[model samples]
Target: MNTNPATIRKGRKFEQVLEGARDIFLRDGFEGANVDDIARTAGVSKATLYSYFPDKRLLFIEVFRQECDRQTLAALDQIDLGAPVAEVLRQAAGHMVASFVNEFNQAVFRICVAESDRFPELGAAFYRSGPRRLHDELAGFLAGVDGQGEVAIPDAALAADQFIELCKADLYLRHLLRIDDSFAPEEIARVIDGAVATFMARYGVRT
Candidate 1:
């Protein structure tokens, strides 16, 4: 699959283009998104839009990238790195669940999966910006705390993955399967506490 789109060039109208693209993509999906509509909404000529993003696929990926970046930054800004271990996990897990269960993100995931065979880059891009980035950040946090003797994680990467998977126990899967949409705060708290206890049981220092 020639999923790799052309290089995205940044210009003065870049943000303007993305602003328009975001609205269109949200309203109409990747396949349904029209370049003409994108240009019209962005308030730029076809030539201008094409100059920044050579192909539709590239533009789509770039939009997802920017949105994912904003979500990640927002999550990170809420986290206090120096906080206690359980509290840190709670905050991170809450954000992770919220992001995964987001309607727009779910739509993007379905679209990317359905289209990935034709454009392999879409699925890979989402994985990179979403789960992979989350894993890396969690692993870094675990490693930092382990060094300080707060946790005993010898393999931070593995532990990080475990923690994330724990957060997804049933709610995340249910949402993806279309079995359910709304989850009460107590349900989320249950998963968070379960994850924290399961993790602490193994890695907590018994001092």
Candidate 2:
């Protein structure tokens, strides 16, 4: 059982490349970021960078995927499964809205939209990593809540999507278009409140 220092160093460098690539992608976006700059930022050679990512498109996809995973997990962690239906929905909607309107997320979304026509795969990857995952997670949660007879959702997946769309409403679109770059805490709360109320009205089981 001999330990290889070369293997350890390669692993360390791999992580550094990912970290540096993520920073570059966030700061410069996919179209603006370059591999040479990424290599320099990561303190790695061009050969090493390409060995890990193969191409800039793959690197951008990896960065977005990692970010989506991190943000989704962080937001879901705020939810309490045991909480009341309205309370749980409110919390979940709040997290979803906040993430959707986040400056970094908005930038990534804009990049995906702007480039998707030329790079269809990037759009698909973004949707799969971000919205699709969130939908699946929310559907699972709603299904469990329905099982408890707290809600009357016939199609948990549809309900999940509808709830998320409701949460987004005009706010996400307005933000995306630069109609308004900032959302006050009260505005966020109001949007979440409306979404939760609308969802509960449709799906809640009355006594």
Candidate 3:
């Protein structure tokens, strides 16, 4: 098997382009960004940008995927599935809400909502790479914890999904709507507390 150095180089350059595009998108809304700006931001010429991404829409999708994957992994990877079931659930909820509230994440989310109809694929990519994957990971964790007698649930996967939805339902909605001035530390605490309470009511180990 022969390795193509050009292909390897192109792959690396594509990664760089995604990073540059993410930064640009964060600094400037999607409508304000362009291939010329992305190429300059990536430290590549127009030729290189077009080589990896023939169109701005394709490049935007790649950038959205890269960012969504990074955030989803970072949030899910921090959970310690070995911890006590209650702790694990709390940690997952805490991490998920915190990551979602992050300025960059919120910005990306706003951009998706603002342009969802115009760029439906970007929204679809985010949903698949982010929440869908997190749900899978959480389901696995919940199933493991259920087997350990830390929680009792008829459906671990459904419980995991519900747990996250409980945590973010109110807070996430407020943030998304820009109705909240800012997230006070105490507000996060309130969300966490409410989420944990709901989780325990549904799945706590009945002693």
lDDT of each: 0.87, 0.84, 0.75
Give me the displacement of residue 108 in model 2, in angstroms. Answer: 1.6
Clashes of 2: 0
Per-residue accuracy of model 1 over 115-191 as CA lDDT, tens digit each: 88987878888899877988999998898899576679999999999999988888888898898988999988888
Clashing pairs in 2: none
Lowest-sum lDDT 10-residue window in model 1: 1-10
Model 3: CA > 4 A from native: 1-9
* TM-score, model 1 to reference: 0.90
Candidate 1 runs further than 4 Å off = 1-6
Candidate 2 per-residue C-alpha lDDT over 37-90 given as tens digits, one digit per residue, 9 for 90 to 100: 899999999988876666677777777777888887887777886889899888
lDDT: the better of candidates 2 and 3:
2
Cα RMSDs, all models: 2.2, 5.3, 4.6
Candidate 3: tens digits of C-alpha lDDT, residues 1-207: 222222223556778788888888888878888777888889988888877766666666566666667776776577776677777777877888886677777787778778899778667766776678778887887777675666787898898789878888677878777788468878887888888888888788877
Clashing pairs in 3: none
